[model samples]
Target: MAIKLLSQFLVILVVLVSLFVNNLVLASEQYKDPIVIGMSAAFTGASKNLGLELYHGSMAYINKINQSGGINGHPLVIKAYDDGYNPLPAIENTVNLVEEDEVTVLFDYVGDPTVTKILPLLKKYEAKNIMLFFPFTGAQSMRQVPYNQYVVNLRASYREETAGLVDHLLGIGHKRIAVFYQIDAYGRSGWDGVRKALEKYGLDIVAETTYRRGTEYNSSFNPQVQILQEADPDAIISIGNYQACAGFIRDARDANWDIPIANVSLVGSESLLKLLLETGRKTQRDYTQNLINSEILPSYEDLSLPAVKEYRNAINSYRGKSPITKENYTESGYNYVSFEGFLNAKLMVEILKRWTDFSDQDQLHEIVDHLNDFDLGIGVSLQFKHPEHQGLHQVYYTTVSNNKFVPLKDWRKWSK
Candidate 1:
């Protein structure tokens, strides 16, 4: 009788232990699932420079976080599609990301035309309500009120960029400024910013010309170049991507027109410099000396700040190493886009860390929409109150010196 009772007790104990082990395995499997993020940007075309930089920069942060046991034990993963900086593919990519890929969030879209194209799709799938965070473009189309509240912007708007560049030019007494823009919403947005800034000073653009948006990065800007050169403005502001903008600069320079050329942030500064050095006739310094571009973030080289130091260290550590997207790692490593991408990812991790239910769209929005006066580690603050989701309101100006982008000290609007 005693042996039979002991056997029954042992059987009960075995069943309980089995249940505990099975639950542990199930829990582990649950935690193994990753957070999926979707992205669409120019990866193979004229705009690959910034597009790839943005990918690596943001991915560095995400990869680090995953290595450190990701937000709430779920790794962050990106599902990206290349739009080649065009509108049609961007629409398809956007829809597929939200529907087929079923990503929890969208991020780091590259161009104005792309983002503008995706807006209606987001509305069509409004029920999905997947939030788009920190697009690379500073175009105002998605940042305006009555704009898709689902969209979030990490960088300063083109309006702010053009305003700062205009302010700098005006302060330095360069009044006759010509606008060289791509014939698209992106270019027109910069044009609008310049116009608004000039209005304050009781002035307007001296001349304006445009190239097609999808022009080959290294293609001819001769028609636009000849027209702008004929205007003979004291200065010209190039508001296209690096490829076309560089083409415009090179062609204009070849025509013996050497006006001080300034560009908006979307031009991809370092890439622009590379083009000038590789394909242009003059010394790199000669072309870059008179060139200026607006920067949305402080220089990544300013390692005195803890955030900048962290960014540099992160990029250094992750350089040429990403399991997800190996192509992002370039021999020519960091730039403004990378720095901003890191910032975007840092903010993204912070946003995701605060919430756990990735399955619930409403849960994500709660954390995002209510981000009030949150102090970003860079000693600046970000907020996402309703009808306005643009995070950074400040802008900085930079110019190339010795093959690097250094601060244009007098042109920065934000205090250090």
Candidate 2:
């Protein structure tokens, strides 16, 4: 009887130890595979600036999270692919990220055309693409149906920026506003927004002009300048990127068209600033004295904010050099990249943690549908519901002084 009792106790002890080991293994498995977040952007070619900045920002945040032991103790892995600012390669990259790498989330890419190409694929897979931040510009199609379900815009929309511009000009008692915009989706969106906002003030656009994407005439404002001069508007609102805007500004100045110049967030880049300064120098010309730049994110030079300070430190630690350029780069400018990428990744992690199981796509959609009023402190807070996916409505106004953009007004949000 004694021998039998001892044998029974030993057997029970062995069973308890086995159970403990099994539990440990299960826990380890949970954290072993880092959650993969895929990114596709114009890492090369014409739009490389957009892609490079985004890549640096996303990587900086990934490093920060990993250093802190990751979200819920699980590491994050970013799988990045260069789409070269082209549609076909973008689709191919999306396929590889979803089918082969099995990424849990998708981050921002550069242009509307490229993103539009990949939207169907995302829908087909019902991809768990949690967030998309700062897609280069505020094209309305990006905020439209089916695509908006997965996108969270960080910058203020073209409509919001134009509204702010109109408000400022109206407050200063300037009536007749003129606009020069690209003839694509981005340009049309701004044009619509400006028209609607002006209508609110019982005003209207006196002159409106359109230009093609790669118009060489954009380099010298002689012809376009002649057109705007003929209109004789009090203020000019440009809705294109650096190359085009710079050309228009230079030519307008050379033509002696003196008026308050305002531009969209798309022109809010270091590269654009550098180009403008260079153009001014090369032509031995000075156009508008007070140039206004509306920004979607906080200025990189804002070192007073804790977030900005942290961002500077992160860039220094990770990249070993600052991301800001002497002509176009600001500490606050680089912040947009880090802030957006970091927040998107964090949101994805939070969603994953709340998920009881990752295998169920329906449950993932449910979680995303309820993600409203999420704040990332980049500039504007985000609120996403089932019917709306464009999370932000705020636009901040800034101006160029001594070749740096300075904030003009408090952040303004648009509704409806």
Task: Name the candidate that leads on TM-score.
Answer: 1
Off by over 4 Å in 2: 1-31, 127-136, 214-218, 280-288, 320-356, 369-375, 378-381, 409-416
Q: Over the full model, what C-alpha lDDT does candidate 2 score relative to the true structure?
A: 0.67
**Which lDDT value does model 1 have at 305?**
67
lDDT of 1 by residue, 388-416 (tens): 67778778778777777898875433211
Cα lDDT listed for each candidate: 0.81, 0.67
Candidate 2, residues 1-416: lDDT per residue as tens digits?
99999999999999999999999998896667687777887655544556666656666766787888776677877677877666788899888888899877676676665776776886677545444534555766667787776565545577778888888787776788889987766677788989999999788888888776545323565776677778888788888756677778777777666677888876535555666677678777654355777766676677766556666667666652222221332333453545544445555556667766667766766766665655454544566654445556777677666765677653221111
> Which candidate achieves the best lDDT against the true structure?
1
How high is each candidate's TM-score? 0.89, 0.78
